[model samples]
Target: MAGGIFVVPLLTLFAGASFPTAVAVSLVSVIACSCASAPQFLSARLVNLRLAAVLELATVAGSVVGVLLVGSIAPGILYGLFAVVLLVSAAQMLRPRRSAQPLGSGWGERLRLASSAPDAGGVDQRYHVGSLPIGLSLMFGAGTLSALLGIGSGVLKIPAMDAALRLPLKVSSATANLMIGVTATGTAAAYLILGKVDLVLAGPVVLGSVLGAVLGARAMVRVNGSVLRVAFVLVLAALAVPMGLTAFGIEIGPLR
Candidate 1:
């Protein structure tokens, strides 16, 4: 799951396994991501409980629905949608994010649902006010994508928080990492019930992902993501073409 989202799911596909095998392997990666990023999220004070709670509501709801719909939908249709999402994500990552400004005048309505939290810099900052509906909708979308693709929506979540909700990249990334495990819980249940998981293939992927997540989290603090974002976009673009072809039932490969 971790490598698929971070790099590409193509490797797992090359292993000649079913979709369940890929999701099962990806779940381990999700666990590792949570374990690796939770500490930093706590230390940075970016948990945003209210926002997470609201988002979870939507995510859980959507995941349940997604599971129900999975059996009815064609695999090609699902993969085709995922390929589109991947391309959009790649584009979003490549562009520079607009800076977030404080919501000053809109403080009254927001104060009821929104709250203040300190950043790693020790300043209490204002977050979304009265935006639960919008946030929940976003999470619902994330959950749908998760169930459909077997990839965590962290890529989408981070960008949404940073771009749509006006959150700092650091806080957004931290919060996104924190939320993945919870979101996965809902979808994983659905996947499990549907028999869409493989233990053996999942084991090594999870092990490698946890170790990799720890390194990725640490690197997030020191590295300038500008270059990384560009490279990631290029990688995503390259992957999208083949994914699109595959989704349309045009087989285009021999092996990884």
Candidate 2:
């Protein structure tokens, strides 16, 4: 999830990779990581398949448009846009979660988005989905950013699901994990066809990211959801600062 934030910068600044190449590698790594983590989430029944599928339609379409625009934008502008996205995501994550309300008759209920899951205490908890339009809009933006910046876009998806769609934090995270691979694959296909992906660099990144994601999935089961949200915000803030600097043509040493 956080891979694209740091990986693109490190690869560009130290490894001398172009923005497009770094983004291509990041998309590949994100796909690998999502693939590694999603099965465990599915087995745990944390993933919301119905919701993921619905949102993916918007995300995939947005990703194709984003990939097409990447070549027209300047690198510095892209960095600035990425930094702004990170900061917005951090702000969203820091906002207090609203209580889930009763499901009203609308797109949410029509799609059967309300569901139950076992909480940490092993009790069933019911959650109602809200604001499908808002969630879909954000998912579209997330997809665009994912392709444009070489990210998994979980930073955007988690907040959209949790804040806008009224999903449980754990559910949002797990569902985001499950959806990221499919989202990245949409953009990765474009990059692959353009020959932007560097197989040598992407190979190691994919392997390491998959291993890390497996470990992260295990840890998610043990960690409190509030703690996970806090950790995510901190990571976004940390990455955002350096990216903000780079957007102004300031150079920081390699993160590695």
Give the TM-scores of the predictions, in the order they appear. Answer: 0.85, 0.90
Minimal lDDT window, size 10, model 2: 96-105
Name the best candidate (by TM-score): 2
| Model 1 TM-score on a 0 to 1 scale | 0.85
Which residue segments of model 1 deviate by more than 4 Å?
A: 1-8, 102-130, 193-195
List model 1 lDDT by residue over 6-34, tens digit each.
Answer: 42355434676655466555755675677
Supply candidate 1's per-residue lDDT for 153: 76
lDDT per residue for candidate 2 within 1-256, as digits (tens), equals: 6467667766776687877889999999888888898888888888889989999988888798887888899888998888887887778767777666546438988999888877878788888788889899989988898889988787678778877798887788888887888888977887798787999999988888888889988886677878887987887788777777877988786542
lDDT of each: 0.66, 0.82
